[model samples]
Target: MSVIEDALAALDLETKVKLLSGQDFWTLPAIPEIGLRSLVMSDGPIGLRGIGWRPDDPSIALPSPTALAATWDPELARTAGRALGQEARRKGVHVLLAPTVNLHRSPLGGRHFECYSEDPLLTGEIGAAYMAGVQDQGVGTTVKHFVANDSETDRFTVDVRVGERALRELYLAPFERIVGAGAWGVMAAYNGVNGSTMTEHADLQIGVLKREWGFDGVIVSDWTAARTTAPAANGGLDVVMPASGDPWGQALVAAVRSGEVPEEVIDDKVRRVLRLAARVGILDGAEPAVAESARPSTLDGAAVARKAATRSFVLARNEGGLLPLDPARLRTVAVSGALAADARVQGGGSALVQPAHVISPLDGLTAALAGEQTMAVGARPPRTRRWSTPPPSATPSAPTRAAGCRSPKVHSGPTSPVCSARPAGASSSVRRCPARTSAGWASRHPACHRPTSPSSRSPRVSRPPWAARTSWRSSASATSR
Candidate 1:
């Protein structure tokens, strides 16, 4: 038997099932008897955010996935992937939960900025290249939100009703391409497709992804996505993530003993998990797919990020040839917008990372026009409710109340940030505001309250005092008149 097969043979039902569930927020438990080590994973489509979200261990943040897609260069995407792979090795990460290949199906999609493009072909090509580069550096990559996770509207419950033709041609195209390119892992999304939840969608996960496309890697659940022990196990979900509240572990062993789930199915999942561990070089007897000597030499992360950012620039209509402004002829330049000074270098949520530094447009232009005068205009953008760490004294069980706003009362969790608040008389039941508008927070709740000031149109919540301070570094150049 092969090394992976041998490892699988030695594991009992409970040990096998345990291996498929996360031991912590970012890792899987290791069994020393079988010569397997803990497998570590982290968030990344742009950069690796390792286990800790602390600033002291910052990552080399790259441009958003959308910006990388705009470059239209598969090679550049691969280079960016290499940088992330290098970062992964430095951070002791075995797999990168990245290269989110979900298509940009809607302009209003909450994660549009995190996606590559509206075009599936382009998304597929770039995704394939990015996945290849990461794996090339001996780090595994999960091509994610598998099969029709195109939007975030009611993500956890929304049933994405898509026809097979539209689904195949548009939504599933990129995933198919990446799988064909031999992706090492796939993350099952939170939503459902047609009527079945993705985590329990056996027909697609087993039938299409594993059978039809022949994906050899593990299919892990998006954190907390696997809701049922039997359904997910039977549905071909090879792994459930992040340990906390996961539906697997002892429940799966119980389900198998009860005949609701087959032991053979559990073995198949264990086999896949072992395969992944072997590829990442955690399994003792198996040779890693990429050796240390084969990896590309050390990369200058900032240089790679700068190149990708510059190449991604798409001047849609330079009718007056106003761009590439001649510095020699320019007397003064005016940079505008709150983003110009405080750049949102990357999209929010799991994709967020603390870069060592950021280059605000204002600083970049000011440096470029060394002698020329530059003026910053417009007020800093209103702070919308985003995930930020609470004060040190705050506990996950603590209740955060937003005064006057009819937002739902939110409780912080051990692994997640608390970014919501509730009004004085709002229902105590936990609920989130439906959505946020550019103008402000929008809600259908009758008791909804608007922000007091015009600038605070969005529901206002307290943020860490240090978050308000602006720190800028000089890098890249942007011109505006």
Candidate 2:
């Protein structure tokens, strides 16, 4: 038996029950007695978004999975994976919830940008390579959305009616490859596969994944995916993410104690969790064990992102071979569209990241052609959506009359600033943006402005919670643009 197995055998039933659920949103509870440390997981198929959703914090943004697949090269995928693993390590994350291997069954899929290809073979090969690369860095990779989670429409409750043969041939193909590649973790999807919810799907979890393919990795429920205690627990789900207020807490423990669910089921799930912990160096005094190694040398992500973009471009058509023009022969290049000046690096959604810098098409062309390029606003897209501050209400009864209610410079949006208020000789008091506070407090609140004495250092302005929900898309967009 392995050392992890030995540790598992020593644990009692109560502690084992605790292991079956997460301690927090992004991590599992640690048992210091057994030397198991809390394991931190993050979102990524392309890049890591640490525990918090702070867009300002910098993270390496690689080419999207579709862009990586467009290259049709598994080697590049592996290189991208290595960079991702290194970034995960740098951020103190042990597991990356990535390599979304679900096949692209339809174009309208909201998360198609995050997936690899419509063809299963390509997704499988690329996913295997990416998983191998990530696991190589002593960080675990989660081959996610177990089966038939192709589209985001009705993702949480949509019951998919797929034929068995087609499902096996296409949908389950990538997962089989990822399991064969020995991914350390698997995330069950929110949608239902066939008639059964994936989180509680017995056949897929116990029959196909665990028995047939021999996937020993931990099976984590998608955030709030597990709906019931008995079904999900018996169905083979190991952990519930965002640990607070989950269905399987004391309820699951009580069910096990009442003989409604066997204790062995909980033991099996705990074993898988511990096994993953041991592999990722979370178990104290246990040597870190990776299923595979990607490469010995660390890779530069920014350099790879530039190179991958070059190869991933698909030339659908070129009239009269008007392509690959010699830089010397070209005098002045004419470019159009605002996107030429500002490129969208990745699609928006859960995986969105504000990269440190993105080189627009205009910048690239200018650099390549020795500053010989001119741009024209042939037609600019209408700014249908923008977040300028509500023009300071002309009314005198507004909140501006308060002691420190000065409006800070409003840029793209009103970044709610932390306000400092002092009355008479009393100490200054600070309060975060009270926009959501009671209506009565907004107009007369004295704590709504900057410090009395502004310092040389700029005060950190924070975007409101609603800013994360705001997103826009242009009608015409190009990879280079």
Candidate 3:
């Protein structure tokens, strides 16, 4: 145990981490010199990051948290916990960041499909189940996004700004129960709670999580989120993750040395991390069995997907007859969205899974309608025909087809750009939108169209392209229209 403690002393924090990795725990690394323990981390309240868990690592995914909660069985939660823990063991992963226990504030949460219900009790019950199983398997489980990591948009910067009563009653409850159930670790969010950063706010991390609730587990800073290391450490955050490729670790050591922070603070923080590692058998002499041949399920894992989809489908309005989608007599469907083909089952960033195959609403609906008899009983099935719109024909246009292959972006630009298109069963021809009124290119486009106010200009980007291009005098003038 002193190995880590002494490393913390003589070796710089980076060197300490480097040394930890140098001591291999299990499965060999692709780069042996980098070492097996260079501090492995994983996602998935459901399972390991099988894709990048490591090429040599063997671990498959389990059901999403939402699906697991549907079983409403703590045993399932524990099994899920055990499944992930076993998977964690396979990879020699030190931290399994998971069990997103944030209360379901709204059904609109994009990631909620992977999370539990809007009720804190349900979230707590399920989160605890996962925490128990993962820790039991000798790999640490980190109950995550600590306080109010509810929304996906602007998640890192949103100011939660809630009252103490509301925070305790709703958002913090699941974490409290999970802590009580022995979650060995926690991860703080990037958002500000009531004008204070969750990582630096001594009130929640220290006053509430540590002292009040008695959470002895390690508190991890959200990836790239430890702004003031000293304040965060003093606030009860134990780890600054995900060991960003920068000199921030060096800064932490320097801060400790310069008396900006006390070494005792570092000791306390590191102790928490070490204690969990010890609990999870990381520092033990056991030669953890390296997982063999385990990878994320290649078989679409439709069972898991359908199960997850079914559980996440809330019955918000049972007003009368809007139940199961009718499979019979559902013909001549007028579809609109391109998303039907490319359904966004998951979000864009870190949580994405390279699924073996994706089943879109179009695919599901098609299958449903295909073999069924007519709306009437035993009637012969109707022949189904599907076709996208035919491209227009007019002036000579840009080549929008690759060897006559049609693409969606073909119509993205100015209608006047004249595009060569070939709809199925139609002869190749140069074409444009039908109406004489053309859709011309504005600088920013879509958002720039029909601006109501100057303040309505692009918030993320510099300014709307058309803001200056158009002859609008003032913001008031723009809004007046």
Candidate 4:
């Protein structure tokens, strides 16, 4: 028997179940008796955001996946992946939860920037290259949102009713390609595909991904995505993530005892986890797929990122002979737009990471056009003021107030805080107010109104539900891209 099988044989049902559930937000429990060590995971595809979200421990931020795909160079994508893999090793991360291969099915998808492209073939090739590069460095990669997580609208509950033909040809193509390219992990998305939730979707996760395609790696649920013990286990979800509200642990052991989930099924899951551990060099006896000495040498992250950004630039239209503006002839240059000043380095959520520094377009142009008078204007006032995470001591129950801002009530929804009205006697100066909540600050915005608790606050910012559309649109009179 293989080392993985021997280790699985030694583990009891409860221990095996424990190994399948994450001990915390970014790691799984280690079974020392079986020579298993804790497996650490981090967010990736752009940069490696280790375990914490802090500015001091910043990561080397790369261009968005969309930008990388625009370059149409799979080799470049592979190089970018190598950089990320190096970052992962430096931070003690074994698995990178990234390289989102979901197709750009809708323009309005909230995470469109995070995905590669609308074309499945392009996305697949790029994703495969990226995965290969990361794995080349001895780290594992999870090509994510496993099949058809194209849009964010009601994503957790919406049952995407896609026909088998569309699924095979379009939605599932990228995952199929990536899996075939030897992906080490797959994240089961939150939403249901067709009539079944992906975590419990046996037909695809087991029948297609494992039995047919022969994916040997672990199938982990997207954080907190696994909702049932037996169904998810039997359906082929190898692991449930983050200790919070996990469906697998003791519940799974009970399911096994009751025969709801077979012990052999548990063994299969454990076998995959142990195999992944072996590949990452965390398990004892098995030879790691890539040795530490074989990893690619140190990479210059900034240089690689700069090259990628330059290559990805697509000049949509440079009408007239305006081509490259002659620096000698140029007397004055104008830069406009709020985005020009406060550039969003990356999309929000899992893709967010603090780079050591971000060179805004205005700053870049200003440096290049030195001595040439540069004028900058915002179409709207740059959102200078915003909410931020309060110190650990400050909580919703304590109700701490920011200097010159009112103590607003904390709410439970995932909406951003908006100051509907200016606080009484407050100056127009920008203040970094804390939008306190049980889940930390959900969002931050320019402070204008007093912060209210959820109990006292009235419904504010009443716009049509569709007002929060993801597409960029401007008025007919406006003159900006």
Q: How many Å off is the CA of 117 in candidate 1?
A: 0.9
Off by over 4 Å in 3: 1-36, 45-47, 50-73, 89-92, 106-110, 152-154, 245-248, 286-337, 365-481
The TM-score of predicted model 2 comes to 0.76
Candidate 2 residue spans exceeding 4 A from truth: 53-57, 291-295, 326-334, 370-481
lDDT of 3: 0.54
- Write out the backbone clash pairs for model 1: none
Per-candidate Cα lDDT values, in order, are: 0.74, 0.70, 0.54, 0.74
**Which is better, 1 or 4, measured by TM-score?**
1
Sorted by TM-score, highest first, which candidate order results?
1, 4, 2, 3
Q: Superposing all C-alpha atoms, what RMSD in Å does each candidate have to the true structure?
A: 14.8, 16.3, 12.5, 12.9
lDDT of 4 by residue, 100-123 (tens): 988875545668888999999999
User: What is the Cα-based TM-score of model 3?
Assistant: 0.62
Better of 2 and 3 by lDDT: 2
What stretches of model 1 exceed 4 Å from their correct place?
372-380, 387-481
**Model 1: lDDT of residue 334:** 36
| lDDT head-to-head 2 vs 4, winner | 4
Candidate 3, 426-471: lDDT as tens digits: 3223323332212332322464345345422112222322223222
Model 1 lDDT per residue over 188-274, tens place: 987777777788899999999999999989999887776788978898899987677777888888999999999999888888889
